[model samples]
Target: MSEPLVVPEVRRLGPARLTAGMDRWDRLDFAAHRRTHGPLPRASRSELLAVADRIDLRGRGGAAFPFARKARATLGAAERSGRAPVLVVNGAEGEPPSVKDATLLARAPHLVLDGVTLAALAFGAAEVVVAVASGSAAELSVPAAIAERGRDPVPMRTLCVPDRFVSGESGALIRAVNGRAALPPSRPVRAAEGGRGGVSGRPTLLCNAETWAQLALAARLGPDAFAVVGTPDEPGTLLVTVNRSPRPPVVVEVPAGASLAVVLDACGVDPGAGVLVGGYHGAWLPPHLAPDLPLSRTGLAAAGGTLGAASVVALPRGVCALAEITAVAGWLADESTGQCGPCRRGLPETVDALRALSRGAGSASAVRRAAALGRGRGACAHPDGVARFVLSALTVFAEDIATHASGSGCGLSSGLTLPLPRQAGERLAVDWARCAGHGLCASLAPDLITLDPHGFPLLRENANLAPWQRPQARRAVARCPALALRIGR
Candidate 1:
């Protein structure tokens, strides 16, 4: 493959007070705030909504739903006479491979808090909840920043819950805060409909941390000012996490319409490789066609990818794409909360099929089974993510799959380039041959590993375990007498 392309790292107009005065930021650390371009103005709900409509502020969360639409939805849902709406700063950076949220929470906590406060003030919210999963650096740094607000504190509270990826979703976070499992419930109830804690359940305004930071900027600079940097429809700088490329990843403030290829080139991504436009759930596109593709949602959708949370991961050419996809599928199956049947059964079936394919033992039936198993099998997008990741692998690396199946590897020296989840379950894999078909691994780690009908092991690969649980997992690993189990890196 040609040497990875060197893309220029583009900076936005100004590194305002949000990111601290630092030249750049790691995933986390609140060092100092950039000099505020101006004061924080007090805008009424309608005014803020109007500003959002004019600037076309879409949810920076991968969905890219129009901010105005969400605001209007909340406004329309409010009761005639009741407590104001609730605002939530979704600091839960659930995407395992992406670290952009942690970066904002740690470095620009104040900015995000400011945006949540402003949203609360505008909407007349009774309270603002900065929901973060426990152990996240955000849970600590953000609260400290909120505490600093003192008497003038942003009517905000902190919610530190479990760190599961789906738990970060607006509704899931709502349930988790209410003391439910950190899993998204079936059906969608906009946090706006039943206010988080009010009688009429005033609408809840939930947005990504980076989204809030941009809103803070937009509120200060006005719609026109914010629009100056990005594309007309997708205005303003988007915070993104670029990874697996030649250059170290960064939280770049890329302007909309910047060529995807140019940005990757600037970031020093491998050339002639498959690019993961979104995060793990994102599609795979060949790098050649991405050069002229714009960076907005529409642009990426046109190019057959989602701009996700701006996770641009470049997979080197030599790696087995199927193996990587299957590995991720295996992880997705592990991450399931097991509340529902489809996700519990379907995800593993999909993972097994993918594993079989990766081992070059799967035939057409295996491919069909994998595809079918991935469809609509989870409480949230976990199953869909695994499916898309697998489907894309099948399409992008068709030749590689054929070769691997023909008793040859993909001829790549590199191992799995895609970052895998690092947790207890992922650290354990069953040795098919070594097992006396023992169901002990399944019984001992029932929350994660399960027993197949044939007395073999069925494991959940992406389950996130608490740090303390590592010892127990080690015990499980040690007890596999046949030495049929191993934890992945």
Candidate 2:
């Protein structure tokens, strides 16, 4: 049976800057938005960069890259190229453990759009394109918001992209804006340099929904006001997706250095087994340390966890954590774009080894080996993120690993607790004993397959294939000459 997610509720530690009027209303239209957030402030490149640096403004996307650095790079590129810059609003919230970006975009879109407008003005951007996941509430609301401000000063429009996990990548979003396949390009150019030449080959600036909303807040409130609530180093309120199953993940706003335990407790989660600090790409915190850790990046890092996208998940004591990790590892393998070997081959192989460890059927060394194989090897950071998540589980649940490895099992069942869209039980695996290395499957589906050094196929296991890649995956499966490749669910 599938684990069901409860509908999420928007929560806060106190009155918020970004989520200003969200408590009284579900969403803000143009009139309400204007009333709630007064007028959007204008900013120069120097002024914006100064404010960003003073407040330590960073991208809310996984990397948490410094916004001022990216802004300067994009602005510098635009000047050198003598071409007007373009701005992309990344609202494609592909991270399964996260709902913060979508929540902000759906509830307070004007805040995000205001940030976009401010960024456009500072960069002298000729055009601005908003990217939202197809079928998401933001898809409808964003365009409507654009229509509301009919005579757009910067020529804004919406592009509904595939709602797949990788579709939110900066390169992928850029490609979708440029009228191409919504997949990350093999050699992804920085958005600073137009990122696959976005919107008619000009330099581009891209940031997620939360990043933009935060920017708007930073501009409205100077560094001192912004610094009031958060810790000294990390200032401002943050939106987090707290997963306490049977109830969907709650999208809550908390002060920068708030107590992690309190947030999880508010969401009715018991951080007994382990707590996943940052979504699937994040690390698992040991039970003892879970409650005491702070929600800031430095705080979590000290506890051997990452505040990646702030997707906090608390694992209940009842479930087998190893089983949960294995299942999630398997799902993450399925979510890979298969753009390179580490993602296609390494990720699935890592999950297999992890599963073996979970069941006491394999050595801890094996899990370590498979998980580490993809380090610094992916075309993107997807494989590395998966590796971090799996490895952390191994450390946090070492006692369980030893218990399971004894050929005796814990009494707990492997029932799901974390929220995953689907395909945790499926995989694409290669049976080495069954065949010769013909490499035909790779030829059949280059988009989804690649050849290893020995000419063996490296591809997604039981790929919950993307809409466009399914046909290719099927064709490759049918054409495998050695029949070594098989997908099982």
Strongest candidate by lDDT:
2
**In model 1, where do residues sit more than 4 Å from their true spots?**
1-20, 24-34, 195-202, 245-248, 372-378, 426-489
Give TM-scores for every candidate, taking all chains together and pairing residue i with residue i: 0.81, 0.88
Give per-residue lDDT, candidate 2, residue 295. 93
lDDT for 177 in candidate 2 is 89
Give me the displacement of residue 254 in model 2, in angstroms. 1.1
Q: Can you write out model 1's per-residue Cα lDDT over 347-393, one digit (the tens) per residue?
A: 66676666666666765357656556646755566667667766776
> Candidate 2, residues 1-489: lDDT per residue as tens digits?
022222258888866777788777677788888899888888888999899999989888778999999888888888898988998899987877888888787778889999989988887889988899887778777877887766867889899998878888888888888888777777647878763555678888888889888889889988888888988999999998987687767889999989988888887788878888778889988878866889998998888888989998878887888888887787777667677888767886787677666667886778889999989978777888888998888888888787788768777878887888754343456788976888888778775577889987766433455344566767767777777776665
**lDDT agreement of model 2 with the native:** 0.81
Error of 2 at 262 (Å): 1.5
